[model samples]
Target: MPRLADIDEISSLVLFVASDDAGYSTGVEFVADGGNLLGPVPAAKS
Candidate 1:
């Protein structure tokens, strides 16, 4: 099952981008889709 992202999870990314730590990061696409972009995970074989 896919897990949903918590508010804190997304907020942390936002906080980092707003902070000086991400100062050099420009024109970057920050994806916070909880690995959804990687496609669905295959089911385990029994």
Candidate 2:
């Protein structure tokens, strides 16, 4: 589960990037993960 802040941050970032304010922006990957990167993972079965 992702936190509200993560979603909001991504949403705002996207809007800003799409607007003229981010005209000078280049290739960038916005990762909105709320510290979940260090959490556990599920097993993938074949």
Candidate 3:
């Protein structure tokens, strides 16, 4: 997704972390950058 993420998308993650569902989760990262860390996509071959 090259475009910016929706508010609900990021909020959902935050909700999960705050909820008991994420009780066991620790020492981890929660990335919400829409694959930006993967770098730009390569151009398609001709």
Candidate 4:
């Protein structure tokens, strides 16, 4: 149900998205978990 990304991952993505390195980047959605949205499962075992 990963609603949030770890600091490192977010930092990396943010850097790239904001950098000239990602000049062509667009419509980036780091949807932490759409699977849970579709399934909507809580208390399911990992």
List the candidates' TM-scores in order. 0.86, 0.45, 0.87, 0.47
Query: Per-residue alpha-carbon lDDT of model 4 for 1-46, expressed as tens digits?
Result: 5576578876887787788987766776655443666775668588
The alpha-carbon RMSD values of the candidates against the true structure, listed in the order shown, are: 1.3, 7.5, 1.0, 4.2
Candidate 1 residue-wise lDDT, 1-46, digit = tens = 2889999999999999999999899889999998898898998899
Candidate 3 wrong stretches, greater than 4 Å: none
- Candidate 2 vs candidate 4: which has greater lDDT? 2
Candidate 4: stretches off by over 4 Å: 1-3, 27-46
- As for model 4, its CA RMSD to the true structure in angstroms is 4.2
Task: Give Cα-based local distance difference scores for all models.
Answer: 0.91, 0.74, 0.93, 0.69
Residue 32 in candidate 1, Cα distance off native in Å: 0.1
Better of 1 and 4 by TM-score: 1
Best by lDDT: 3
- Model 1: residue 46 alpha-carbon error in angstroms: 2.0
lDDT of 2: 0.74
Residue 28 CA displacement from its true place in model 4, Å: 4.6
Task: Encode model 2's per-residue lDDT on 6-42: one tens digit a residue.
Answer: 5677889889988998777778765667668769666
Indicate whether candidate 2 or candidate 3 has the larger lDDT.
3
Tell me the tens digit of each residue's lDDT in model 3 across 1-46.
6899999999999999999999889877999999999999998899
The TM-score between candidate 3 and the true structure equals 0.87
> Candidate 1: where are CA atoms >4 Å away?
none
